[model samples]
Target: MLTFSFLLVIFLLTILLAVFDMMILDFSIWEALINLYFPEVATGRSFVYTGVFFGFVICIVGDFRLYKKKKLKKNHAERDGSP
Candidate 1:
């Protein structure tokens, strides 16, 4: 959950940065997304943008694994008649 929350914050910030680039820097939405994923075309924030996206994906996978682990634990506890 902590990882998810952190990634969520970074993702939101990335979105804001993209919007800022579009509004203030006159970048098209497509250009902004492309620049984020491709470092060669970006000024210098490519690492941050790419990291945020990949971190978001990792967060999702982590959350799913956590959920499954909790569910399995609960099932085991119920089967063993323990709290």
Candidate 2:
């Protein structure tokens, strides 16, 4: 359930960011990501993609870490016979 919600939120936010990029920078999500690697080939948009990509990576990594920690704590509690 938590994973589902996280994915849903991420999907919606990614779409929102992509739309904003298109409206303000005139580029799709794919183009923005590509531009990060090949600036000379995919020039036009600003450096917003760098932040967006980094934010995405951070969010995903943080979420996974939190989920894993929670799961481990739950297992530990169960092993210790705690409620």
Candidate 3:
């Protein structure tokens, strides 16, 4: 469970960082970030718009499931007489 949680956090953080990098690229802010991770593609040659949109959807679903899981765990603990 600990290892899984650590990897999940890293995955979420990486996606979030990529999203941030995309947002900044719109206004051309953070050239260093772009150069380091996301090198420039040719003009009008892109696929990231769809990817970012799906990222948001995935994040929403992930959050909802995470909340549900926590809530379920809390209920189980309470049923077991946890203080």
Number of the top lDDT candidate: 1
Return the TM-score for each candidate structure.
Answer: 0.50, 0.46, 0.44
Residue-level lDDT of model 1, residues 1-83, one tens digit each, is 95769867867987887888798868998787666556475576767778877877888888889999999999998999965
Tens digits of lDDT, candidate 2, 1-83: 44556568977876776677677888877886555346686554446667656766777788889989999999998999964
**Model 3: per-residue Cα lDDT over 3-60, one tens digit each:** 3554588677766776676687653435534553566655543566567557666777
lDDT of each: 0.79, 0.71, 0.65
lDDT of 2: 0.71
TM-score, candidate number 1: 0.50
Candidate numbers, best lDDT first, in rank order = 1, 2, 3
Among these predictions, the greatest TM-score belongs to 1
Cα lDDT, model 1, residue 50? 85
Q: How many Å off is the CA of 52 in candidate 2?
A: 0.3
Stretch of 10 with least lDDT, candidate 1: 33-42
- Estimate the lDDT of model 1: 0.79
TM-score of 2: 0.46
Clashing pairs in 1: none
